[model samples]
Target: MELSPSAHVDTFCRDRLPPFDLWPQLHFDLPELRYPERLNCAAALLDDAVARWGADRPCLLTPTDSWTYGDLLRRANQVARVLTEDFAVRPGNRVLLRGPNNPWLVAAWFGVMKAGCVAVTTMPLLRAVELAQLCEISLPAVAVCDHRYLEELQVADAPDMRIVAYGGGAPDDLAARCAAKEATFQNVDTAADDVALIGFTSGTTGRPKATLHFHRDVLANADTFSRHVLKPRPDDVFTGTPPLAFTFGLGGLVVFPLHAGAASLLLEQATPDQLADHVADHGVTVLFTAPTAYRAIMAAGKADRLAKLRRCASAGEALPAQVWEDFRTATGLRIIDGIGATEMLHVFISAADDDIRPGSTGRPVPGYRARVVDEAGEPVPDGEPGLLAVTGPTGCRYLDDPRQETYVKEGWNITGDTYVRDADGYFWYVARSDDMIVSSGYNIAGPEVEKALVVHPHVEDCAVVGVPDERRGMIVKAYVVLKPGLTGGVTTVKELQDHVKRTIAPYKYPRAIEFVADLPRTSNGKLQRAELRSRAVGAAG
Candidate 1:
């Protein structure tokens, strides 16, 4: 699909450009580089916004409460003092924050930064086993959890971790201690290179790896992507469905809005219908969510309620062409789809309004360079598919993991995604390199099959994966969720399989189908193909 030109988005693209020197050994000094010896995200981003925008402006909004810029700053400082004087949280200390998306989570996140501690945010839905694994790896000193999810943090084996509960009856003892303390707190003296947060990747293919980001790296994303790609206005309100624990959601819903002096509409429950209601009620201008949510909103015929939105961004997975087309037809808005990872901090490649190419993930954003490389790290031809290698202001810094060598080679961060760059520099996403199914000497991407099924009227959600087969070595298997009125049966499965054959290459059609009520998704709304593959293997066994 082609995108028409827009003055606002087009101006942003024109002002940002790639580095002049493109050789393998050449490096160019960038004028936008502003790195201080000491850095604190709370001071550099949030405090600066409050000072420039004034105290009256709303900084964060939840269903039940709203905090002004000054209010948020004061509360963050209060939490910072409590963490430092009472809990002994200091530099290099890791603190775990597990809760639903709310104003308290934002306050605690900034407070952790102000106290010069590393904030390791985990999903609220994580079970004891997952929580234990994260605790073992991160070795957090303190845990601040919402009262609703306190049971999940009650692991029998978590060693010497302090638990602070919020949203319950704020214990008088704890409240008294906090109330007595002064709200004025100084920013911790931290270097720009000091690690601020440890974001764990959603391990759909392997064990989850922790990706560390420095203080400057955090703000760099706001400068590059938020300034160049999102361009959120100060009066705009932002809302999204991604959990704040995920870096994609953290940047889009929290950091970007704070950096831009805009307010974020936070929701404890982020269903599609609820999100639409919030957008209409709050006059939210910018919306960040996944492709599935967009499809659901269109399916529900509620796109008209989003008339207040000025920009819509999709991430966490590839955006299907059909979803994009449907949204444009319904709302006359082009959904900006970008590919990002926890390792990259934020989106490195994206399309602005003028340069959008449907079925493509757009060109590299400013301050970042992307290349498709062969197995030996050599650049491939423009049209040939290869592993996507990216280098920019923010890159992966894993936590004591040997896999760092595999992901970050030399200076470039090697994303496991396979992509093809066209002659015009538009990057087309293929699939995860490891997820490419090789069957009878043919390469098949699971997303291709899933996209085909989504275009069909009966399919709601689906996950495609490769299952072990003696005859073909690996066979395509699709785990599908049908629409609300559609019934899953043998005849429907055969018809869907035939639909896939007609949509794409015949060999890529699903050999087997399992209709289910829902697909297993991560807290960030990414499809967990690994879980589906495991289920298939277990069934075969």
Candidate 2:
């Protein structure tokens, strides 16, 4: 597989891509997936949309501010100028973006793309140590952070990474620098296959891996899922709870909306109550969030505020069948449940409207194909559970990691989950085939949590597992063996929880902790996680 002539001046990312033979098969069967060899996605999504649609149309809508398509271009252009002039960033240089979801964060992303630099978006909830690990992997040359959350990033060890703060009145802030730059500039001519962004995802080992996505891959998702399934209208207003750092939110709030010339409302933080109010006040038609939030919104008795919503999407965790039936009964809207991975980018398997099955994650999107295969990759009989493998316009491509071989087997991306494909082609939910804990729409690794817990001085050993929760689909539970004569009680639990939170992202901290004499281990000295999961399930019940 010979490569195309790249537009990136710095070839670090292209040099690190897994050898051509190790790459997953990418099929561009859909007409929309066809793209020009020389293309920049930022220019395609933003510049082209403004030209096709009127410049005066609202593009990004906040609660108090509305940025027209033309306005967003000017801001994004300024940001691009600042990157090249102030920070000395070159094309293909990794620029780490840290911030909550907002108009500025969106602008920074576009600006990075326009300048031909790869954007590395990290979740705002990540603590200092987690951020440091990502920075070490990507080696970002510059970091753009929100002023409110600058402390943790400042403490993180980012090699040769200069920090620039946004959303501040300080004279040296990113906004202040942008004001001094020109309002217009020529965008970079990056190739369609050039790496545009790197999203970090958790592996079972607890260490994060950088997932590389090309400029065309960004639009491929919108073309396949958003075009065929979501079917967005130009007048639609989209809002969601997932942070922009996550690919789900990026597709829903930014890529999908911009691709369709629709308006998006960027909320930095919103509870179920506040989200309901925003929907009613702003006439939000397209909504995206997890099933837990949908349940919470109804429990808060804010169902009336969701009267304006027409389409809703649920992902991150599986949408329970009962919750789906209950929400549909109340709102007269059937939520679209999809299964997507960081590797695949966005919802490759989903159902919308009349095609949706309550208990099944619907058929593959128009462009993609899915299969349930045995250990040897042979197709399993219909209704029998096996590995869920997917391949289409987009698939996983890890940057310079040996795990690439594990993720991409043969020609398909083998998502580490077991599922059953019915005779009708509807894929039903079963269970995760790996040790990942999907709690509150976040994928947490048990090994990662165990590493954080075992570092505490009072802890002798620890095991983390996902336990069923009525509220959240699953909650991270930890069993710990204390050192010496400490009879662990509430005080011990609180101390250990705080320690784990400080060591890793707060969301990965074990919500439920129990004292144990020892963890179960097999004769080979490997931890028996299956036995513990059973014990945790019993204790949870």
Predicted structure with the largest lDDT when compared to the true one? 2
- Model 1: residue 454 alpha-carbon error in angstroms: 0.9
User: How high is the lDDT of residue 204 in model 2?
Assistant: 33
Residues 210-296, model 1: lDDT tens digits: 777778778888888888888988888999998999998899989999888899998877778778888998889999999989998
Candidate 2 CA-lDDT value: 0.88
- Candidate 2's residue-wise lDDT over 1-541, tens digit each? 7766888898989999999899888899998889999889999999999999978999999999999999899889999999999998889999999998899999999999999999999888779998999998999999999998899999999758999999988999989999998899789999998999998763334578889999999999999999999999999999988888889989999999999999999888888879999999999999998776786687678988999998999887567676688789889989999989888888999999999999688999999999999888889999887899999989999999999998889989999878889999999866567667898898787766876786587876777889998888999999998876888999999999999899889999999999999877521123567788888898777
Model 2 pairs whose backbones collide: none
Looking at model 2, which ten-residue stretch has the lowest summed lDDT? 521-530
Each candidate structure's TM-score, on Cα atoms with residue i matched to residue i, is 0.93, 0.83
lDDT of 1 at 217: 77
The alpha-carbon deviation from the true structure for residue 513 of candidate 2, after best TM-score superposition, in angstroms, is 12
Question: Which stretches of model 1 miss by more than 4 angstroms?
Answer: 1-30, 172-177, 204-207
TM-score of 1: 0.93
In every candidate, how many clashes are there? 0, 0
